[model samples]
Target chain A: MSVMASTPSAPVKPKSNTRLRNTLTFWAFVGPLALGLLVFVYIPIVWGFIISFFEARQTVTPSQFVGLTNYVDMLTDPNFVKALVTFLIFAVFIVPTTFFLSLALALLVNNTTKGTSFFRTVFFLPTACSYVVASMTWRMSIFNGLPFGFANIVLGWLGVAPIQWINKPDPPYFWIVLVTVRLWLQLGFYMILFLAGLQEIDRALYEAALVDGAKRGWQTFRHITFPLLRNTSVSILLLSLIAAFQAFDEFYNVLSTGVGSSSNITLARPPLVYIYQVAMADQNYGRGAAGAFILVAIIIAVTIVQGRLFGLGRAEA
Target chain B: MTVNTQTDTGRRVIDRSERIAIVLNYALLIFLSIIFLIPFYVILRNAFLPSKLITAFDWTWLPMPPSTNGWRDLLANTNANIVDGLRNSLVIAILQTVGQIAICSFAGYGLARIPFKYSNIVFYAILVTLMIPGAVTFVPLFVLVASFGWISTFQGLIIPGLFSGFNTFLFRNFFLNFPKELEEAGLMDGLDHFGVFFRLVLPNSMSVMMSLGVITFIGAWNSFLWPLVIGQRSETWTVQIVLSTFMTAQTVNLPAIFMGAAVSILPLVIVFLFMQRYIVEGVKMSGIKG
Candidate 1:
């Protein structure tokens, strides 16, 4: 330790041997982590892709070569097509709503005066709670059908008919529940993101805008805040889309069971939940694996298109 | 309506704008806060209602009068060992948090500081894993854990969760914002990369570590699906898992269920309330990317 410490102040001499030893030591430290990641995450993912090609059914004499069989079924499966459409509809609803809501909240919280943290905490507190618990609470207290839930009671106060948000005939209503629950939960996380973006802006810009007799309304936002936050907007948009695409837990608990089968709410289930059913409930492992890969492909494709459209990835590169 | 107008500038009429902006800001914030808080209000209000009085409508609106019935029922026969669920949950949450913090920081340090070969490849590998959904890996993971003789034990629950690619990515992402000269200085001072990383880097990155620590601990505490598979025994069930069992009942004691749900969400909410300023600061500080 003393010898190594003395190297900074004392006469420095090149020691090729020590450098080589340090490099070796670094590799040694990294070896276990790399191998673990390979075997656990990477290998399984590779195996998943390979497994997609075969009919890996346990009931028969194990998995065998059924080349293009999985993809063939996947291509023709009506439910898969339906789920894709439904999920597209979900993303369209969720992404924009989350985008604006978080932006609006960030604007609101950016004031950061006394007790602003309280509102921020209250808003973000739900993110810490799980989907299952929130869903259950929503089911019990708020969305209760007739006069049972909070939404109905509020509607009742306004002399309106109770619209079953979850159990309505339109599957999209259920999508709304899923989407809103998702938005409500994730607002604070993104708000934090936006707040971070806000802090990076040069205060001089706001001052300069103020100097030009800018009003409280459009000028402050247009000249000062909006231009500064373009990059953060792209990120929020991408992350929101990804989260909507991967929407699982809320949908799982809110809408009971699978679509085209027996959904207590509506005939709409997202890809991951549908895949979960195909894999776990029906034990259709091969089909389920194929569906998962299909979803992954769609997510990657959509994310790429979005990244290009927003110019986010190009800027990063 | 207070404004900072000590300077004389005909061009910049800022005092009126600042006052108007302050009022508009508070009004807008208060309005947004109402919108943001409605769901939480709904959950909190309805949980205390008597189950029978609850219609599928308006069941959980304003508490007419506070009622303890729901809570009493939810915790009824909580377990043979009363605190076992809470105990197990705490243990798992703490262990997972501590373990993940250690592993992620070390890996993050290695990635950020150690000038090794193929470092970018290693970092990208971590990032790519985030896209692979848990549904894809659950089966193989289940098989792997089962094979390792780790099922239904605390070790099985805690060990697999300790290595998080996302957390590592977050730390390493924030680590770049730090001036490398301090680490370089430490390197010159007799400190190896590991020593510098341990002593100098971590000490400076307390906020990032603290924020991630809270998030990680809460996540571990609320984990259900993984615990469901691994926690085979009744005693092994987390509080959330135990509460979920009530859903399977044909006649759900609503009060009890709500009570349990409320109980589960409380500690997290409390933690957020107390540590939130630091938490938000930490998250913002950590959001800096290369």
Candidate 2:
């Protein structure tokens, strides 16, 4: 209530009087954040790069400087190659599925007239649910390979035998468990993004299209809605790509049964999981750091190439 | 006459199709809602059912005579340390949220309102960090924290994440659009810039603060990998790390697992239900700016 600017007093301060104080205040405000970024982000990233050139495993200090050996080792390692290939497969599977599904969901919710808020909340509830919980739910209750598990229970209804979703890595149907959990967790978040984009479209454009012979919803969407939603769609795709590459939680937790099972590593380990194993589990921080940089390179290259292809940040066509 | 009769039939056909469409729409929505809700239902039911009866899936959809065995077991299990995990997570999340709000908003206000020569450079430097994926810095950050002997300490878990670049950017953008008149009035009354920020600017920032606070709190609470690595000791483990321990252990207690999962996410679900509008609004805000 006291936030009004209508008080009667001097409107403008003498500029020179407060300049020095202003400068000091400015630094006081911005200093902490800059210091945080430097210590946590900038310095650590540089250290990560420097450590990748040496053999700094199992110890805090780096004494041996085998330039490019760590990088070369990771590049040639079968496990690293396997991890990259696995992530690529995952990205390929998840990116489009999530994009299309979220868009479809956004369209559905947008079309609804009543209980719109109710449906939106229900769909968005999973976004609040942690991936750890979701992964556990999927692993034990849904796809546990038991006769009475949720997926198997449904399979029984069709007179089919229960499938070992996580254990059968030969054909790799575990992708179902991985992909579905991510889809359920992320779809509603992206749906909200699409809804925001949809809300921004001019109603007049739709009315005009309908009046000028666009009698079907599909036609109107094709000519106007889809094109206008391009920016949101591109951003969603880019974010999904980044997230897919960073896929670790569900993959690590769901596939591994916690004891003496080396199957999870060879099953579908992503770059982060691979790096975690190499660094923490094996005590090879040098190689782990190198693997991290390599993964970062791939992510950067993909992002730049995708941005160019999509003309992301460019004015609308 | 023929054209008029044709129009009449066409309109009736459209009405009948519209009726069918509405029915089909509700059916599809209801079907998907059930699909979305089943996992939650299963977890909730299993959390209340006795551990022995958990695997006996005779449509255990609703817990019969709902027992508290799972909750009792989880709280009593010393190795699990679910309560301690929850406490640590709360400390980290709350302190980190407070720190972020203070640090980011101050910098945001400085960048947006203060007429400084190097502000743009500072802003862009922070922005550039966003492009670098967190994977690039993960190992070295852990190394640095370890060197400081901060492993299993609150400083290690909380300090590095105190300020978010994206959040600082959000605050800057929000402050830029903020009404300058309020601050100008404060200045007219002999209040300095800092005074104005404290008295007027911050009070008016309730909505943005709430949005960022909730989002950041949820993120900090649900974070797994970082806490798993940093808080290796059972004493310092966050709720996520503790729950994940169940996944990695030799013995799997189904009821305890469900209950732990349920309890881990309970705070977020409560916050979301009560402030659903703000959360949705927050998503929209991020989408527009992002």
On TM-score, the candidate that comes out on top is 2
Give the per-residue lDDT digits (tens) of candidate 1, residues A1-317. 98888888654355665666666665654555566667667755566666667776542112787777876787688877777777898888888888888887887787768777777776777777877787776665566555656676778788987767777765445665677678778888888898788888988877787668776557788867887798888778887777677766677677673344566633676776666666556656566667767777776787668767768654764
DockQ score for candidate 2: 0.63
* Candidate number of the best DockQ: 2
User: Candidate 2, residues A1-317: lDDT per residue as tens digits?
Assistant: 34355444324443554676677888888999999999999887788788889889897557699899999999999988988899889988999999998998888888889978888888999988888999999998898878768898888888888888888777787899999999999999899999999999999999888779786568888999998998898889888888888888898788866554565646888888888878877878888888888887887788778878777446454
| Candidate 1 stretches greater than 4 Å from native | A1-20, A58-62, A257-261, A312-317, B1-25, B56-65, B77-85, B130-156, B173-194, B223-236, B285-290
Query: lDDT for each of the candidates?
Result: 0.71, 0.85
Give the best candidate by lDDT: 2
TM-score of 2: 0.95
Clashes of 2: 0
